[model samples]
Target: MKFVKDGASDIGMKLHPFTLRFVDDQAYLEEEYRSYYFSESISSIRITLVLAIFFYAVFAGLDVAVAKQYQTQLWLIRFAFVIPVLVLLLILSYRPWFRKNVQALVGIGMYLTGFGIILMIFYISKIGLYTYYAGLMLIFLIGYTFIRLRIVSATIAGWSIVLTYEIVALCFAHTPTIALINNNFFFVSANVIGMLICYFLDRTNRRDFFMRKLLEVERNKVKAANDVLEQKVQERTQQLLETNVELKKEIELRKQYEQERTKLEAQLMQLQKMETIGTLAGGIAHDFNNILTPILGYTEMALEEVEEDNTLRFDIEQINHAAVRAKDLVQ
Candidate 1:
């Protein structure tokens, strides 16, 4: 009989908090998850960095073409700040050390990107604020798409950007109340939405990881059971082979015994025949001796009665001698 537990605990289910502060409970899965996350994020980081460079180049060119007053500052921001940070991220993505410190690297790269955008916003005129906001959205999207940060790291990076923006908007931009409220609402909403997406994405990936582990465990179990069953079958087959060999030996021995028994029976029959012949010969000799004894006795009486006649006496003696010889032969 198989015993199956019928509860969530039996299935290894645990209640996890939705807050970003809560760490994943599956400690055994950490290395495997890290490897997977690293491979995926590395490729994405390279692609996103390349795209960022291209887009920034295009924006810088457009600014030059339009003869914007802060074109030099824009170029400096793109080349010095943005390009260097992206290059650093690309370099780190290839390095083994980055895999060991993935969360930290991601958080640092995100902060650099956000800080670059904030610097651009500060330097660029108010009219170009919309363009910088668009750039910020792109950075946010890239964070969601490429970086794939853990819950704590993502929360830290995301809120830090938001706080930095709020402070910059208040102190530097010095915008009107209604516009500040609108910008805050929009940026906050965007951050919230991005956080939700990252949360769900991380959750989904982890769930799949757990599921794969479970399937692997089940497969191993089945393989072990099959191995045991195969071993038993082999053992049983070996036993049967041994039994068959023993049976063949026993059959050969039985046949040898039968041949010996037949030979012994033939010898016994020959002995019995010899015994019967000997008994018959002894009985005939006994009967012949009885007849010879009577004959000799009669011959002796006749010789005594014919004693006066010499010729008759000689004939009687001859008869007695012949009878006596016959009696000796019978004995």
Candidate 2:
């Protein structure tokens, strides 16, 4: 109902000390993100399939046009492009994770393989051309780059570029279909170059991903370890405080015991002194009583012998009084 701010607060503003928000775990957030990505990926795949179908129809129409106008044998090449692209789209749309990771690689690899096969067919048909196919390969290369599939994506792009260049050179060379084997140099060179570039890029990306994941794991581990260490320290500190409190109490008790011991010692010494005094007082009183009895008897006999007018009588009374004083001192 009420709040107090530790620092300066505006007139209408209130700060509640206990108000706090607990964030979700990192793993949970990651899982949620992955799920979102998977869902979006499914939609993208469906869109890709629709686009592929439209493009396949267009390629079919183009094949018919070329065949009607030029009597070219692009049918096999055109149909080849259509069938593979269709298969790839359907596979991606229906089974995103089908073949696990390798299948996806193969699916992407199929694009280049299909392009190469179409080129081979064109060369075989004596209607080999670069102007028509090169643009399509470039477009596919750029699209594959955007997919961000690391090695597979880079492989697709690199191969697309190299193969398109080779196809162009092959057209310029005007090599016979029978002599295609003699152009193996270009084929081998393109494959090797593309593979090397993709390999390098893939390695770099892999290292980046690995380092990021490692840092995240280490950060979480350190935080967990620190929390455990803090709890242990708190427990140990509390235990030490309790132990110190007990020690202080023990010290106080010991001090009290020592004080009581000292008091008892002093009391014992006092009692010993009193006991010695009592013994000395009793012995002196017995001797003084004996002395007084004789002195008193002598003094009384002298008083009777002297008569009422004798001068010695006063002296005898004085002696008797002096003896009485000595007896009182003894008592």
In model 1, the runs with Cα more than 4 Å from the true position are 1-15, 19-25, 65-67, 126-129, 176-178, 258-331
> How many Å off is the CA of 72 in candidate 2?
41
Candidate 2, 17-57: lDDT as tens digits: 12111122222233333343344344544455556556554
The models' CA-based lDDT, in order, is 0.73, 0.54
Return the lDDT, model 1, position 7: 31
TM per candidate comes to 0.71, 0.42
Which candidate leads the pack in TM-score?
Answer: 1
Candidate 2, overall lDDT? Answer: 0.54
Residue 330, model 1: Cα distance from true site in angstroms: 20
TM-score, model 1 to reference: 0.71
* Model 1: per-residue Cα lDDT over 1-331, one tens digit each: 1111233222552325564231335443556667876776677667777887777777777667543787888788888887887788777777878788878777777877887777777765366443466667777777765667876687788788878888887898766677668767877887788888888887777676666667777787799899999999999999999999999999999999999999999999998998898788778888987877787888788877776757788877887898788777766
For candidate 2, the TM-score is: 0.42
